[model samples]
Target: MIEIDTKKLVIGMYVARLDRPWLETSFLFQGFRIENNHQIEQLQTFCKTVKIDEEQSSPLVSFEAFKPSTGRLNGTPPPPTAAPQDQKARFYEDMAQAKSVYDNVSGSLNKVLTEFRLNNYIAIPEVKSCVQSVIGNIMHNPNALVLLSNLRSKHQHSAKHSVNTCIYATLFGRYLAFNPEQLATLSTAALLHDVGEIMLPKTIVDKKPDELSAEEIAQSQLHTQYGADMLRKITELPAEVAEVAHSHHERIDGNGYPRGLKETEITLMAKIIGIINEYERLTNNPNPKLQLSSSDALKAIYALRDSCFDAGLVEGLIKCLGIYPIGSVVLLNNGSTGIVIGMRQDNHLLPTVMIIRDPTGELRHPPKAINLDKFRDKEGKPILLISKVLEVNSVDDDLRDYILAELVTKNKPM
Candidate 1:
């Protein structure tokens, strides 16, 4: 740790330790990055010197200078046109509409990927069209698509991981307020980020990703180069597509390959894809022994922050998908197994849950919907709270299956 005056701190540096007791200050996070001048000014107001751990610090980034994903100016995020409650309601209302868009994306993207695997020329426009639909779904109300994606986890198609990565990257891009054109490009890059894996030896390509051993991962690194060269050779695709394919494995701390580019040397888009791609791989493994729940996977990524990924972007990821994101099967204080269908922006702890099992673990038909924030006892105390976030695989099979079936048949988790 090095002591530095507040004046010397830059935008992306993670402040490891403060000069004073954390309780004495109003800062919500004990350790954080100086995202804007206002934060630097706050530090300047609070302390003269602070400790910086260089390993955890990211070099200065000017949002205006380079937008890693959007390929455009990173000005202020556009203001929200609708209130938060309206946005939450939109998720429920758009399920049917979102389903149609999702079906189109999965079906068409699969065909394109199949053609690619067969060494047939795949049309760029078809892939772009799928990404366009994803961008639209994300902009409208991401939760419907979010819930659908969670339910579709059982589909077991080869393209499922890529599709999840595309949807999530688009969600994060929308959260970052990328314009439609920028989002189209970002989503397209995300969808094709792993296209090179199709060219690996069938023995390696055929195995579920989680089953790949350490040496197998090393052998597969060439896929990054292959994917980049393949995408770059396509006349119609944008340069960023190739760039992401080439660099998504590149880490900020310089440990990644095949190029081992570090810090700002990796584009913002590549970092975004890297985070999403890894997150998808971590959470979506079909092997029950290997699968991680959404929250568990985020925690794993959190442990590698600054070393493997950007701290701010990692925080943005957690922010985009709340602590117990929708579809997390959780055990509540009342001893019921509930699925998190909606999150409360006001309080991350208390979400809108669909109780699939009764307190005795009996299946509940048309699982009861309860908004924890509003579900109060007669005396007005919060009656039910999430006790723990359960791993999706750990949940009773009967309960998980019932919820998925009901959501599809009834067209709502509620």
Candidate 2:
């Protein structure tokens, strides 16, 4: 089977895979021959691409034959509108609020996980409260919560991963303009996406793939079902939340384990969680060699689009988090180095950065915050452009110390 843009799909072609889950729509079979304009129109509305059985297709059309359309697809719910200008003026305040929210959620998660490890029944209300707090912050400003999530500690991988995934899933949902009710469900599902891992032996979860025996690999993959079962036992939670736990590991191409469920079989919320889960693991893998930088993680996910994830959702993630996401360490064209603190809505590539090192390679005692979108040199030329993204620990100086100090300084009362 070969992948083709949905616009290139024609009557008489056999669809082997859709960009979305098969069960979510009305398609009768997992694979079917497109027989009429109605089928093509439906496919176009829901999918950006589909895998076609080359041997089963009629005459193939050139990609250039089609043009991309803008705006949300027909029959799809509209994304949440952008925050009002008055609300956006409180970005700093929102960010500060997000920090407090992050701390509370983190503490609550730690306590909850401790209980789970002891096989104690979880306090569903407490977990729900934390999820609500995260949702509140995300509703105000998702960027702040997302930045905190990206700066997670490696020591608390499992707990932090859960928190980060929750934040990211909420942010992605917001970007898609999901209603408050939808956002809440998505956040709850993400918070417990990895609960099954608590039942697995640490040695197995953390083992290097090369070192793991066949049986160890199988045992490790059981976390999805384990987590789903645990969530189902919580009678108060939505069934969709439990489905997210079960299907977050599933892929668009039917390669994922536990069930190998493909497009349309997986819920949209699960697909969002799956994308973020893979991204978190890629960036925070225990093995240094396996860990990817934020930019690299995005690239890796993009590379897997259509096969491992839906193409449309992957694009949504990239747009939600700018090209150089918050917390990304980058080198500038003028020889300065900095961590991205804010993204310019009008120009994603030009973010607000805190310059930590000067062109002379000297650490600035008071790091300079420059909004690349508005920055210009004495000659009226742009002063700095991001040359490349750097690894989290590439520099000798401690980034967390500088970042925190900068945030505190910026948020200081006049």
Candidate 3:
């Protein structure tokens, strides 16, 4: 122990307790003048060994008496790595499985609808499993949007609507960053969102996209109520989930059908499905004679973002799908036309595209997927690319064949 110019003394180079407090609680060091009566008594008892002023001593003593417990710190924690390829493969596999389950449920629902059976569709174990699987796929795979874009009309209107709703609902859920559990619930709501349509007339239901009369539209809207009623029959169905399916048709501005709920009254999940449903329907080219490109469909939806769609959700859709989404052909500044392969995370505006043909006025075989990020000129300026929006089938090229070939750019995640 050593005393410095200051009133305090140190027990060791690092560890030091107050001299007075140390005397009362821990008697390890000694030899200091006590100013108070309390200190004098404490210090007297504490002083087993003593040392006065020592010239060679520092203020701190090297008393190695006590040791503190420590924790292990041998290695560092591992960071999460990017797994794009695995994610893409998993997405495809999950989507295929979802399609199978969706088809089965659709078939069963069709039979019920045709027979006019009032039995609860949700009560079926297989139907519930199908809904769960589809929802799970949406929650896990970001790129599953491509697989869910179904336009082919099967015999069952409710089934097709359910699949479409499920896809859009899941996409919207992903856009909102909904957790897996929330996504699954939202997916179930979407898939079964239009089960009530089964009750509608076959003539009105089978009405082509071009020939939808006012009565047909009104009758079609009834599906929302019909679906809700079916869901209500199932005692196990959660009220929140049922609400999503029932209220998906209701609008934010109080202009929607059925109850005509506005704003906060409309459940958030329903609102998401509503926006996505409308967008998908408007954009989908039901007429094989005049099909709209994916880009055109998106643009059409974007045009209605504020008035019809929830502003934030529309923005999220744009962010998720990218500006030039899949299935749209674009003419680059270099005079080459290519179909968009997939969206790039960093640059959503410029997605990875499959260059099918050069400006040489000759069609090329086996289109090549090129990353616009790497297509820069020598001066580091961005090259002229995708100056014009070319609708699918707008050009003379074989759009289907181009879509079938999946040659994506390096480092571009699915």
Question: Among these predicted structures, which one has the highest TM-score?
Answer: 1
TM-score of 3: 0.64
lDDT of each: 0.77, 0.77, 0.58
TM for every model, in the order presented, reads 0.74, 0.73, 0.64
Clashes of 1: 1
lDDT of 1 by residue, 1-414 (tens): 457788877876667678998668766445555667888998888999987644335534332322224333568555444354553343445667667887788888888978887775777889977887787566545666887787676545557777888989988986686755677778999989988887788788777766789999788888999889899899888789899999999999999999989999999899999999888777777676777889999999999899999999999999989999877888998899888886634467887787888899887875776778887889988877888888666775565667666665455334
Model 2: CA > 4 A from native: 1-96, 206-211, 377-383, 405-414
Clashes of each: 1, 8, 2
User: What are the clashing pairs of model 1?
Assistant: 68-269
Give the alpha carbon lDDT tens digit for every residue of 127-225 in model 3. Answer: 556555555444333343343343233122446666666766766675565765676677777766766776778787677756888777877878778
CA shift at 202, candidate 3, in angstroms? 1.2
| Tens digits of lDDT, candidate 2, 1-414 | 567888777786768678888778776445555778989999988899987754334444333333333356767766554343333334456557777888788889888888877766887888998888887666544567777666644444677878988888887886786866787889999998888888899898677666899999899889899998988989999999999999998999999877999999988998999999998888767666667778999999999999999999999999888899877889999899888877744468889787888989888876776778667778877766999999855742366656665554366421
